[model samples]
Target: MQIENMVAIVTGAASGLGEATARALAARGAKVAVLDFNEAGARIVASEIGGIAIKCDVASAEGAESAVATVSGELGAARILINCAGVAPARKMLGKQGVMPLDEFRRAIEINLVGTFNLLRLFADAASKLEPLETGERGVVVNTASVAGYEGQIGQTAYGASKAGVIGLTLPAARELAPLGIRVCTIAPGIFETPMLKGLPEAAQKSLGEMVPFPARLGRATEYASLALHIIANEMLNGETIRLDGAIRMAPK
Candidate 1:
């Protein structure tokens, strides 16, 4: 479907991949909603993109409901929902501290897996009631996963499991939402130049980038956003998890 004037909600839009997506959508004439837990950052992004910022914890029912309500009141029903609100905390199941805290694993699942489903469920329900566009598409949902989901390295038990759950969610979600004209897809990205990675030493970052089989560098946020736009434009592309990993199958650490 055409993005022009379409109401789109991008979670975790304060920075990184989500921020890039929000900007890209707005640049294409979509009315975007910048949703993030960082209210100030969200507001900054929203202001710059001419969108609205809503503080939301995508993992919580109340938070999701309130965010959806705010967006609906301000921007109309969202035709696109981008799930980029996730945490990537690397931890071993058994560390020097002993067995990993169960809460740590739960937190990862809550934000990365459950948060995605929560937002998608809310968005699908709203999109189903809307009139289909010229392409007979009511909405599109783009979820973010990670290469770690497939080749989980050492010290990534929690992070990898959460992302794998996201990968597992894609096809079933697409099948269930297809009849309602809502498409669902997931993007499993390799190491990117997000703030999280930028925090590392330059040598460490470069070493990580060199791990990619080709291009020998980190993936750019714009590249991910470009693929997302393509997915939104191409209706036939659904129920699939596209790996934006630069041919890099991660090695077990």
Candidate 2:
């Protein structure tokens, strides 16, 4: 889809990858709706980008529906949806602290997996109604997964499962939406320099960055956003999960 004059909804836009994506889209002349649970941060970025900020909990069906409805009423249906909303709480099934709580695991699935599907469905439904562009494409969706999903390490039981669900969803969703000219793609990122990683000690962060096989650095949010823009523009790219990791196959911890 053309970025100019297009409408996009970027969930989890409060910080990290989502914030970067919203900024990139807005900079490209797209009208972006910054959706996030962090009202203050969302508002700050939205104001800066001349976009609208909608406080949303993407994990809830009602919340997702209401936010999407509001965006449609105000900025037109989003032709591009970048689902950067997700949680990564690392915990082992049986940890040194004992087994992780069931609620913790459930919450991870709810927010990461279901939340992704929630926004995706709403965006896909709305996009389907719109007449296709010259390329016979209606809209595009970009989801965030993680390297852990492919190779779940210790203390990543919940996070890995939720992310794995996203990758597993790509082909099926793309096939289902193919006739409607809507594409579904996923990005399984390696350790990125997001707030989550920055929270770790500098030494710890450096250690993780060194784990990458190439470049030997943490991935940048702009790099992911750039790839996402390309995916949206490339009509032939559909129903695939692309790992944005630095050629790193994670080893079990």
Candidate 3:
């Protein structure tokens, strides 16, 4: 779809991949809505991109609904919906501390998996109502997953399960939404320079980067954003989960 002057909504746009995508979309002349739980950070990014910032908890039914309504009312219905809001909680099901808290697992699933579906449903409903373009396309959705979902390492039970659910969601979502002229796709990224990773010591970060077979460096947020933009521009890519990892099939740590 042509991004120029089109409205786009990016969840978790306060930082990292979401922030990069929001900036990229704005640069391409799309009117973007930056939605994040971090109100201050969202405002900062939105201000810089000249897009509106909305404080939203993507996991909540009421919150997600309100956010979608607000974006539709203020920026018009968004043709591009990017699901980037998620959490990565590292914990073992059974460790020295005994069993992990059930809530912890639930939190990861809620934010990473359910939150994605919540937004997708609301966005597709609105976008499907919009007049189809010349190509019979009404909108596109890009979801984020992780390499860990496929090859989860030690202490990644919750995070892995949540992301795996997201991976499982792609093809079915696309198949169902196809008739509505909306396409769905997912990106499974390897280790990257996200804020969470940045918190690690420099040496630790380097060691992690070296795990990739080639390019031997962390994935960049801009690279993820680039692929997302391409997916939006490419009409034939649908119901697919493209791995943005640099040939890194993770080991069981």
TM-score of each: 0.99, 0.98, 0.99
Write the residue-wise lDDT of candidate 2 on 162-243 in tens digits: 9999999889999999999999999899989999789999999989999999979999999999999999888889988998
Off by over 4 Å in 3: none
Candidate 2 backbone collisions, by pair: none
* lDDT string, candidate 1, 1-253, tens digits: 8899999999999999999999999999999999999999999999999999999999999999999999999999999999999999888888898999999999999999999999999999999999988889999999999999999999999999999999999999999999999999999999899998889999998998999988899999999999999999999999999999999998788
TM-score of 2: 0.98
Instruction: Estimate, for each residue in 4-120, the C-alpha lDDT of model 3 and write its tens digit.
Output: 999999999999999999999999999999999999999999999999999999999999999999998899989999999998888899999999999999999999999999999
* lDDT scores in order: 0.96, 0.92, 0.96
Prediction 3 global C-alpha lDDT: 0.96
Give each prediction's root-mean-square deviation over alpha carbons.
Answer: 0.7, 0.9, 0.6
TM-score of 1: 0.99
Error of 2 at 250 (Å): 0.8
